[model samples]
Structures are given as C-alpha cells and as structure tokens.
Target: MSEHIIVRVAGVVEETAHVRTLRLEKLDGAPFTRFRSGAHIDVVGPTGVLRQYSLASSPLESSSITIAVKLEPEGRGGSAAMHEVKVGDHLKIGKPRNLLSIADDADQHLLVAGGIGVTPLLAMAYELYTWGADFELHYFTRSREEMAFAELLSERVEFRDRVHLHVGVPRDQQPEILEGIAGRLTSASHVYTCGPVGFMDQVRAVLAPTVGDDHVHIEHFEAAEIDTSGDSTFTVELDTGESYEVPADKSILAVLEENGIEVFKSCEEGVCGSCVSGLLEGTAEHRDNCLTESDRADQIALCVSRAASDRLVIELY
Candidate 1:
C-alpha cells in the first residue's frame, strides 16, 4: 500500500445537484506539498474502497486541497460514500500523483472538458492564469445547473474572456462546435481534454487532424474496456534474476504479488499509473491510458500492460 495522510474535511461546497467539492486540511496541521495543476489523489472512502479524484483547487494553495466528487448512483459505491461525508470527517488520502500536466513548449494551450471532467482542467486554468500563459478553456455540459465550478470559471478575473461554457448543446450538434474549435487550432497549439470516454473519443477524432496526435493529450478517469481474448502466456524476469510465467488470465502485477514480490499499486485498471515499472528489456504492448508514447519506450504499467515479446525484463524500484 502507498503512504497516506490523514485529513479532515474543512469545508464543502455544493457545486451542483450531484457534485460536491470537499476542501481537506491535514490532521497534523502541516501544509500540503504544492501539486501539479492536473494531479489527482487516491481517496479511501468510509466504505474502505479507494477511488482517485482530481485536484480542482489551485496548485499554489497549500493550506487545503480540494476535490470535486460527482455522485454516481448506478455505479460503484465510492462516490456515494463520498457524497455522504460531511465537514470534520477524517479520511485517508494518498499523496498527489500527476499523469496530466500543462505542456511547457506549447505556444498556446486549448483545454476542453466534459461534465465532471472539468476538475483537472479547472486547476490547469488557474495555473495558466497565474503564469499569464496563453490558453483557453471550453467546458461543455448538458445544462448550466450541472456544470461544476461555474462561478469560478465565469466570475473570476483570472478566467475572464478565456473560459467558454457551452450549455445545452445537443449531442449531434457537438461535432459542429468541436469542428469550430478545431479550426482555431494553430500548428503550435496543444490540446488537452478530459471527459467521458465517448466524449473524449469524439474530441480526439475531431481535433487530432488539427493538432496532430503528438500534440493532443487526454486524461481518463477510467480505463476503456479492453478485450483480452487472444492473450498468450509470457515470461517476466525481474532484475534479481527470478523469472515468472504470466498467464493470459492473470496480470503481471497479480503474478508478482502471488509470488511474494512486493510492488506498489493502486487503481489496477491502469488509469493511475501507480504500477508503472522500468522495462529493462523486451517490447511491451502498451495498454494503459496514463502513459504517453515517449513513456512507453522504456516503461510499462505492470497492472494492465502485457509483454509483446516472449520474455520481458523489469526493474522494480
């Protein structure tokens, strides 16, 4: 398990009918380390189930870290449990981890968010405002009432004239709006987006032609459904020279743990990048959503990725 810090909910804001923002302060009264703009933390709920939440607060704010949770009645119980939490409730949370961040070399950043996916992009907007960087944020929602951080995006001087909120846009009409957004993209513009998989897929399909695949980035709250019907057994060798055969039905991380080899992991679905290990040898069939193409060259997410070659050599930190 990863190290966790005890925190008390200091404040709560009802962002929408289904979304609540919790502001947490360390129980020990220590200031939180400044996180990257698009970082997320693993929140262990009252039900003892761990879920990752993106930090919506400004990275410069160390006194408190804020996470917005949208209740999902039909889905897992973690969000439902979080919705029941009140101010003063104590909880354990992992250190902030970042898989998405503002690119340093972009001439201008285009931030696109869908529904509850606005959390991470909100942080990026705050950071971009602080740096006086050129950027624009587009948040799309079914209605204004469902949009989180509406006031912050609309009323804040930092976001004035830069944040565009699209409300009540029909699904069929979204493509036209996205096309307009894509038309404004310059060769140097880098696009970053977070949302439901379908919404993100549409964004990628529409924008990739404008910015190219290399300059387009995405942040996934959950991994896409993957079909592993054709997976074959493979051999994995650790730096210590121990070898293990990973079956098609088992994950590399599970095989390692079953063999008593300890590996730090969270969000085994490969959305958190927690089980990423150094690939000393062999090619990997990358399957994780969090790793960039460059990262895949020498690293692998042990939780979901499989070896492309018959044998793979991994280094555990």
Candidate 2:
C-alpha cells in the first residue's frame, strides 16, 4: 500500500443537496504538493473504503486541495462516509494523480462535463483562463439543483462568458445540442470529456468524427462493465521470480495480496492507475480505462487487466 498523507478537513461547502466540496489542509501544516489541473487523489473514507476524487481547486493553489463529492446511495459506502465527515476531522489521502489534462497544442479546447464530472473540468477552466487559452466549457445536468459549483463556474471564473450551462434539458434534445456543438469545431479543436459512461460514449461518437481520434480525450470515473465469463486462468511472475496462479474468478491484485504481497491499489475497477506496473514480458488483455494505447505497450494495470498470453512478467516496486 502507498503511504497516505493525513489531512484535516479545513472547510466544507454544500454545493447541492447531495454534493459537497471539501477543503483539505495537511494536518502537519505543510503546504500541499502542487498538481496539474484535473488531478485526483485517493481518499480513504471513515469506513476504510477507498475512493478516487478529482481535485476541483486551482492548480496554482498549493496551500490546500479541494475535492467535490456527490453522495451515491447505491455506491459501496465510500461517499456515505465522506458525507459523514466534518470540519476538523482528519482523513488519509494519496498523492494527486492525473489521467485527464489540458491539451496545449489545440487551436481551441472544448470541455464537456456531465453531472458530478464537472469537478475536474472546473480546475481545467481555471488553468486555461490563466493561460488565456481558447477554450469553452459546456456543463450539462438534469436540473440546476444537481449542478455542483454553479456559482464558481458561472460567476467567479474569469472565462464565465465561455461557460454554457444546459439545465433541465430533456434526453431526446441532447443529441441535437451535441451535434450543434460538434459542427462548430475545426480540425485543430481538441475535446476533453468526463461524465457518465453513456454520456461519454455519445460525446465520443459525435466529436471523434470531427476532431479525429487523436484529438478527442476521455476520462472515466468508472470502468465500463466487462464480461468476465470467458476469463481464463493465467500465471503472473513478479520481479523476484515468485509465481502465482490467478484464477478466472479472482483478479491479479487479489492473488498478489492474498499471498501477502502488498501493492499500491485504489479503485479495483481499473479507473485509477495506482496498481499500474511495468510489463516485462507477455501480452496483456488490457481492460483498464486509465491507460492509452502507447501506455499499453509498456505497462499493465494489475487490478482488472488479465493475461492474453499464458504468462505475464510484471515489475513491482
């Protein structure tokens, strides 16, 4: 497991009925590490369940870090514990990591966010505004009440004119709106999107044809549901030459930890890259949402990915 930083909840803002933004300061009073926009940290909740949340604060602010959380009653209890957190309570958090980041070389940047997915894009807008970049943010929600950081996005940001809010838009009307947005983009326009899987899939399907696959970037909060019925047993070899058999029912992470091999892991769903390790040999059936094609050439996410070959050799810290 990775060593966690202890942070005190300095303040909390109720953004919506089910969402809250938490301001975290180091318990030891040291300055927090500066991270790029769209970075996320692994937070261990009071229930000891770990969850990854995107940083909503400006990257320029190093004094403290902030994250917005939307309470998910159907979730595995992490958000519930976060809702129970209060100011002055200390919590354990991992260092910031980013899978979603701004594209600097684009002629124009288009950020599309849905529901709670606006958290990371809010940070990106802050950074882009500082750079005076050509960018626009489109936020969509079921209703105004469900939109997080409404005031900060519309009123506080310097690029408020570039922000567009689509509240209470019916599902049937969304495709036309998305198509209209896609029609205005040039070949040099780059898109970054984070939202529900279906929303993201639609965004990609609509925008990728205009901007091309290389220019369209996606960030997934959760991995898509994968069918593991066809999963087969495989062998994994550590750097130390120790071997383990990973059954079809169990993940590579479970096999390693069961044998008392500690690994740095957060989201077992493969949305977080904490369990990503170097691939020394063999082919990997990559199922992770975190790694790109180039990344898949040399790396493997141990949590959800499986071996395409009969055996795989991985390097661990």
* Candidate 2 residue lDDT tens string, 1-317: 38788899999999999999999999877888779898999999899998899999999888899999889999998998999899999999998899989888898989999899988998898899899998899999999889888888767755479999999887667778889998889889999998898888888888889998778778889777889999999999998899999999999999999999988898988998889999999999999999878888989999999999999999985
Note the Cα lDDT for every prediction shown: 0.91, 0.89
lDDT of 1 by residue, 1-317 (tens): 48998899999999999999999999877999999999999999999989899999999999999999999888679999999999999999999989889988888999999999989998999999899899999889999889888888778887768988899987678889989988788778888899998888888888888888888889999787888998999999998899999999999999999999999898899899899999999999988988888889989999999988999999986
TM-score of each: 0.95, 0.94
Candidate 2 to native Cα RMSD, angstroms: 1.8
Best-performing candidate as measured by lDDT: 1
Determine which window of 10 residues in candidate 2 has minimal summed lDDT.
Answer: 151-160
Best candidate, TM-score: 1
Judge candidate 2 at residue 210 and give its lDDT.
92
TM-score of 2: 0.94
- Candidate 2 wrong stretches, greater than 4 Å: none
